[model samples]
Target chain A: MVHLSGIKAQNLTEKGVKTRMKILETAEQLIGEKGYYETSIAEITVKANIAQGTFYIYFSSKKAVFDELVYQLSSDFRYHIKIAMEKEDTFEAKQRAGFLAFFEWVTKHRNLYSIVQQAVVVDEKLYRAYYQKIAAGFITSIGKAMEAGECKSLNVETVAYCFMGVGQFIGMRWVVWRDQLVPNDVFEEAMEILFNGLTHKGGKKNWRISRTGYTNEQ
Target chain B: MVHLSGIKAQNLTEKGVKTRMKILETAEQLIGEKGYYETSIAEITVKANIAQGTFYIYFSSKKAVFDELVYQLSSDFRYHIKIAMEKEDTFEAKQRAGFLAFFEWVTKHRNLYSIVQQAVVVDEKLYRAYYQKIAAGFITSIGKAMEAGECKSLNVETVAYCFMGVGQFIGMRWVVWRDQLVPNDVFEEAMEILFNGLTHKGGKKNWRISRTGYTNEQ
Candidate 1:
């Protein structure tokens, strides 16, 4: 809830904003690779190819800069998801698009997982706030779906976390660990589990036979 | 797979084993509370009421003990899930039980999230191995369920991660964050989403009707 836009709002020339962003981007990459504890302002400035004094002009300190990066990461992610979801016609489509956006964004910003996870240790409040922000986005959309009879009448918040968790674990498993996009079949299977669940359709069938030649009856 | 069982395999008396376990328990507690880098062997030994020199007899160094603790946490968790799942007859029931076991276990072992997450920074291999071990367990069981026509025919590994992700996020949300058992209704809702998905019954029903007195069509 703190107003942390990652840059000073007042008295900023266009070039100053650009320099500040450069410093942040450099910090994000380094912190993601080397870790927050190991990274320093000097390193960030060096990587940004700016004077150490220039770094101070954009941020107060190393911790301050780190906080800004966290704020930006969370904001940027939600923005991407929102934009991706807007292109979809239905709620389900929107949800899928949102997930795909997350994966694609993470693929480019590879340090996201590392940096976010580190927030747990570096700043617990920031860590919780990051997920809470994302959950809020899910809650609003899921609430709408529940109202329209598209999603089950379960607790919306619980469903939000469930959806978030599934995306997170799947992303970590394939994207982060394997350094690849989630395979199409894998993504589809996960979505099926999310949309239709593991249960078979009606007593008419013993199990849902997916294209992969497996039977599922949740 | 790399045989990271944590402690050195050496000849020891019953008392030595007990002593070693005491050290591990103390270390697990401290590391979980304070983090791996912040915790030290002296603190663990002192907490365990053993001599600092006694530590080397059981483990080689601080990292060794940390690795051992990670191994134990994973093993103990699988054991709990297996035992809980055995009480259920169907795969679906087994999964619910497994998730319940996880939530219960994490509730009791509050440091679980921190400790396992810390492994990402402390030892990336150990962290990956931890999840991989859990996934392997799920894969084997889900594979069995698929063969028996009790579950859907999807990519088994993807399904395994999906299940893991759901349980983890759900647990993290309710048990870890809230410091309470997942409310029965909340748990049931999540299970419904996992087993039946967000979609409502039959093609006639476009989306599920939530008990929250709303119909969803997303």
Candidate 2:
């Protein structure tokens, strides 16, 4: 049986499992196309070809289904990245694989961005948990790499957030917005900045204090 | 005269300007507090202490006001970053100042994240325009720095997006989420990764190909 948080899925029969998945998938499509407030439970039921009563059998309320959709999408993408990263030996390769996996997965689930973004207001805690969960995975991998001297020693949390930001914006720009795979050169350039710093070796010593009083380098 | 896009603000008297500002401010607060769909025009006018007719004098519809709020906020934050970046001499210093300015600005307008995220559903094009405008600013600054040999030469657009992602995530994590100024150590560490890159100097040569076939380094 497929496990879903906060839902009793273990006792679900094979047909019951399919019904629940249908409900979630239908929610993803309707909520993704229409803003959460604009989509009605009745609309979801109609599109899913399930009775209104059947919908209630799976989800108690619209918010409940939305929360589950966000949770499921988050888990799905993280699982993809994990599997991709597992095939790599080096930290850098692992990161690259993870990014590639993310882009590929998002391409298939284009509504992932809209559904997730709506969570900011739909349920602020759920939105935070979505990113925090992803960031936690990054923190663990980066922390291990740092301990092994495979990467620079910085605040793992900060670096994890940075990694998350890069992956998200790149995916949003190329995959979700343009409906295309991230171009090879663009992917390479992002990795270039990720694996190596942006400053040319010769320019590394040029850090300076600005008039605003913030130090540019440690 | 305070300039506003899509609104004829220059012709307004001082009172007209104030009323218009009031409407936008009220919208920001309401839309930021409650999701856009939940906030009504009547509630906005009531909170702004203006009559329903007075609200229509400034904005034609709820979406019009919401769009204007997003435009104004985007312009405001970009202006802050621009002024901050202008105070620095080196590329690194300028970037640091820009980030500091962003965090400071977000602290004041804690709703910026929610308001912008809502734009994804309220108006997709506005959402894209918001990030594109910021990226354009980064691209211009980073392009000039690259030509002057202040930073490494890479895809300027990709680097621009990277810079934006770093600033945004750092701000979202610290200023917006924590409701505290980004701690000094965290700020410095993010700047370190942004300017120098995440991999250590010694690990620069450790790039390798994984089973997934993506290159880790250029």
Best TM-score among the predictions, by candidate number: 2
| lDDT tens per residue, model 2, B1-218 | 12365446788888998999888888888899898999999999999999999998888999998888888988888887898788778888888888888888888899889989988888999999999999999999999999999888899989988888888898899999999777887887787787777886754454454322433222
What's the lDDT of the predicted structure labeled candidate 2? 0.84
CAPRI band of model 2? Answer: medium
DockQ, candidate 1, comes to 0.36
Q: In terms of DockQ, which candidate is strongest? A: 2
Q: Indicate the worst ten consecutive residues by lDDT in candidate 1 chain B.
A: B207-216
* Local accuracy of candidate 1 as per-residue lDDT tens digits, A24-95: 889888888777777888999988999999988878998898888888888888887898788766778788
lDDT of each: 0.78, 0.84
lDDT of 1 at B24: 81
Candidate 2 lDDT by residue in tens digits, A90-126:
8888998889989888888989999889988889999
DockQ of each: 0.36, 0.62
lDDT of 2 at B144: 95
